[model samples]
Target chain A: MTCQELLDLLHDYVGNELVIESRTTVEVHISGCLQCGTLVHAYTHTVRVARALPKCNPLPAAFEARLRAMIEPELKDKPAE
Target chain B: MFDPPPEKLTPEIVFREYAPRIYNIARRMLGNDADAEDVTQDVLLQVVRKLDTFRGDSQIATWLHRVTVNAALAHRQKRANRQKHESAEADDDVLGSGGPVTPGKRWEVGPEESVLAAEQAAIIEKAIEQLPEPFRDVYVLADVEGLPNNEIGEMLGLSLAAVKSRLHRARLRMRDLLAPHFEGKVTS
Candidate 1:
């Protein structure tokens, strides 16, 4: 695999959707190529950082209060089902 | 012994536990707190009134996920003035074919620095928000929420191929946007 071929295959490799033969070719190419290796590493690192994003954004105090006010009446009146 | 699902489903539980999660999903999707708060409130009101809808067969978390996605998408639609910013540089993907990635420009940051990336949350969030319309949706669902691609395609009414394409583009865009921060910062 040349550099462009490897670049074209980067997404498939990152997604783990590449076939084994194609995968090995990519691995072999990057194994010897420092630039491609760093590119691949940085690419994977980007996805990893995105995955590590905080899963919860806490409701601000005023927003929480308003949300409570909006729902409290319905919770009191409606029979849940 | 496990508490009955009913015992666990209370207004307080919804407020204390699920609300933050719903807000987070909306915040990421809407890219702003005001819009997120609106969708969060909308979903919470609906959840409290019909809390038992998912009581028998489905788990509350699963149901909330669907509801939150739907609500956020719908809420974004109501504000449908989002300009088409499909950047001209869509072809300018990171490390694209025939693009030269010189060694001097490659990221020197290693995997161990991932923990520190969280401290750069402002940049991360801005990069995500900058992603043009629909690609942002797929990126959030796949990378942020960790949802399966098929599920994301279903939610977005896109085919599997479309989801894959959008996600790939989103990742490439993200890499280019964040490279300035981490690149050449050889963290020891």
Candidate 2:
């Protein structure tokens, strides 16, 4: 494969989204091409770093309370005569 | 255990299991604490109201992500409308001014890798926040949430190929945005 084609497939390859036959082709290309190899390595590294972000945004109290208020009436009114 | 049927959408169970993930998706999509919180509330409330209609065609989290993205987009639309109507003023604030910019500064990690990882994540988040809503929504759902292409396609009401195409462009844009930082890391 050419450099552009390899780069285009880099994300899919790193994320394990490629089918076996396609992945084998890409792997073979990377094995011989230093440029494609670096792109894949860096692309994979970037994805890993992005995934490491701290998922830490707690919902606001008022929002939760409002949601509870909206649902409470429904819960109370359900299953009643 | 797997999620119970949608009719049994208990807030306690939902909050216990899915809230964190929901919050993460919202934060990535919206980039603000208040908006993320509002979207999370909206998603859960939506779950409560719409539970009976869920057909269990996809994973519960995938379903929840669809709700979450819709809620976040709705919130953004409302804000945009408000801005248009009032000719709203822009806030002259710097990044990291909203919520805790970093997660768990108290948590430990290997020094060099952690610093590089943190910087890389910040760059990515900024680039992601700048993407137009259509692509941004798909990117967050697919990459950040790590949902399958089929599931993402279902959530967005797109064909699987469409999801893959949008995701590919999103990745390319992200790579371009972060190329500066990957200088030493990538060989070519």
Candidate 3:
């Protein structure tokens, strides 16, 4: 792959989201091109950092109870079969 | 056997299944805890109110995200309108404390990492946040949420080419923004 083409594919490449042939070409380019290689490293590091944000509990246990109560008004008077 | 209509739209089911992903997207889009929680709640409430309309043609997550983006956009609009009317009000009152709430600087790093990694991450988040909505939406969905381009296209109702273009531009812009911190990691 040319430098520009490889650079364009670098995002997907580092995400490991690229197709096999494209990945091979990216690897080939990275093997010989120091500049493209650094770009790939930066992209990979960025993806790692983005993914590493702490996954917190999105809501408390009581939230479900609260949400159920809030939504129940819409369900009132439905035939209780 | 004929079936009776459903008794209720269960927030429990939706919350259990979808809340984490919804919160993740909200955090990325809205960039704060309170707003993300509010957006998450609003999206779930909308789901409950509109469950019957969910014809199930697409994945539930995509439909939920459409509700999310809509709700967030509405909230932003409302906030903007209020700000316009209160242009003379104390900026602190509008901002809810002081000069832009500082984002947490620390990463949940493994015990062995160096300071360089943390600095890189901070730079990257700043860069991601600076991207315009269309590009940021596709970038977060694809890169952060790990969705495929096809699914991202479906979620945003864009063509694959359009998604690719936005994603590429988002990355390029981010690379430029991050160049200072990532100096050794990219060539000019």
Candidate 4:
């Protein structure tokens, strides 16, 4: 597998979506190609960092209050009918 | 595949259960607290009004996902229109820019770097916000929400291949945006 071929398959490789035969070919190529290996590492790290992004902070109290207020009118309009 | 039908949901139940998640998706997509809040309210209201129409054909979460995405997209369109009307020149500049400006902070190589996490998160958030809408949606749903490609495709009405393609492109863009900070950190 050439560098460009490996690059094209990087996403599938990282995603584990490649079939066994193709996966083996890419792995063999990456294992020997320093540049391609580094590229894969960086790509994987990029995914890891993105996945590690801070979880969404809880909604602000003020915003929650506002949301409740907004819902109240709707609730009132439908009163247990 | 015979799965049990989704349970009937009440407005209060939907609000209590889904509000936080819905708000999170909106915030990530809209990149503004106020706009996200508005979307949350608008989408929840939509759910309440349309509850009777929900036939249990899909999970409640999937239904909410569709509604929230639509509402967020609409909100974005309205904001874009208003900005365009207010100042065509400003709109042109913002629209013309491919991505947010690279963060100004320089990277260093040690314990001092711990302080940079918050800034790094902010920069990533901005970079995400700058992604074109379609890619942004897939990235947030896939990477941030941890949804599978199949579910993302179902939610976005895209094919599985399309979801994977968009996600790959989105990840590559995010990597480029963040490469400066990760320099020296990633190695062979």
Stretches > 4 Å off in candidate 4: A54-56, A77-81, B1-13, B50-58, B83-120, B186-188
Q: Best by TM-score, which number?
A: 1
Q: Report the lDDT of model 4 for residue A53.
A: 69
Q: Ranking by lDDT, best first?
A: 1, 4, 2, 3
Per-candidate TM-scores read: 0.84, 0.66, 0.61, 0.74
Clash pairs detected, candidate 3 = none
Candidate 4 residue lDDT tens string, B1-188: 11233476566766666677788889998778999999999888887777666545466666677788888878887887888743211111222322322322222323223233777778778888877677888889888777789988887678997777777777767766766766564232
Better of 1 and 4 by DockQ: 1
* CAPRI quality band, candidate 3: incorrect
lDDT, each prediction = 0.76, 0.62, 0.59, 0.70
| Interface RMSD, prediction 3 | 10.2
Better of 1 and 2 by TM-score: 1
Choose the strongest candidate by DockQ.
1
Q: DockQ (Cα-based) per candidate? A: 0.54, 0.26, 0.23, 0.31
| Candidate 1 vs 3: which has more TM-score | 1
Q: In model 3, where do residues sit more than 4 Å from their true spots?
A: A11-23, A54-81, B1-10, B13-17, B32-38, B50-59, B73-125, B176-188
lDDT (Cα, tens digit) per residue for candidate 2, span A1-81: 876677667657877889999899999997997666655554554455555565543555676576567667655543222
Q: What is the TM-score of chain A in candidate 1?
A: 0.86
Candidate 3 recovers a fraction of native contacts equal to: 0.15
Candidate 4, residue A9: Cα displacement in angstroms equals 1.1
The candidate maximizing lDDT is 1
Question: lDDT score, residue A9, model 2?
Answer: 71
